[model samples]
Target: MAAKWQVVREMDANLIDTALVEAAYANPALRALFPLVSHGSLQFSRCTRFPWSQDLPSIFPYDGERHFRVRRLHEPRGSGREQIGGAVTADEAVELVASHLPPGCGPALDGTPDDLESLS
Candidate 1:
């Protein structure tokens, strides 16, 4: 994935989605990850750069019901993803994501993963 990371973000209140906000506060750990929206769904990244890896789970709020859904993004795009579980609240959804986080996963990287690669 050598494409640039282009995320649609509107700081304006009217353009923002409530679900994105809900997912942000779902968990402190989730809050720590870089938040972004993909195809109207809330997704988090472990780094603030392009080509977001499958390091974190993607969460979606069902049809404005405010019900959160946590899913694991699998490789080979369009192969479908795994449904980890569902949550009545953002907190619960993030809790599920938190448990599945990679071992030793910390706050999102401040830079691209490539930045780290160069450091080593």
Candidate 2:
């Protein structure tokens, strides 16, 4: 059986993550991307389906407390994420992420790039 403390810890994480996701969705810009909650981090992607690009940015709770960190995902492993900025609330964090979105990025594509290509 799972330990009680572990279960509680997971529940707490979920609550924090859910709140972050809700805040992200409230923004029209983020409502289109696929949102994911990992531990206390909130990550966004440009595709709703699988095989998401790892180059997108992620929002993490940082500064040893309630502060949020918006960062860019780095590839090739161990390169370290690029810090976008810090926010004190979920709304502020969402705004930071939304403001840094890729140029001309619209609502997330419905599927993989290949799926989009075939439509051309």
Taking every candidate in turn, the Cα RMSD to the unseen true structure, in Å, is 5.5, 7.2
Give the residue spans of candidate 1 off by over 4 A. 1-23, 75-79, 115-120
Residues 1-120 of candidate 2: C-alpha lDDT, one tens digit per residue: 113223323456545555666677677777766666667787766655666545567899876466788888566224589888875677788888889887756466768655644755
Every candidate's lDDT: 0.63, 0.66
TM-score of each: 0.67, 0.70
Candidate 1 — which pairs collide? none
| Local accuracy of candidate 1 as per-residue lDDT tens digits, 7-75 | 333344343355455545545676667777765566767777776645577777655666777888675
Best by lDDT: 2
Clashing pairs in 2: none
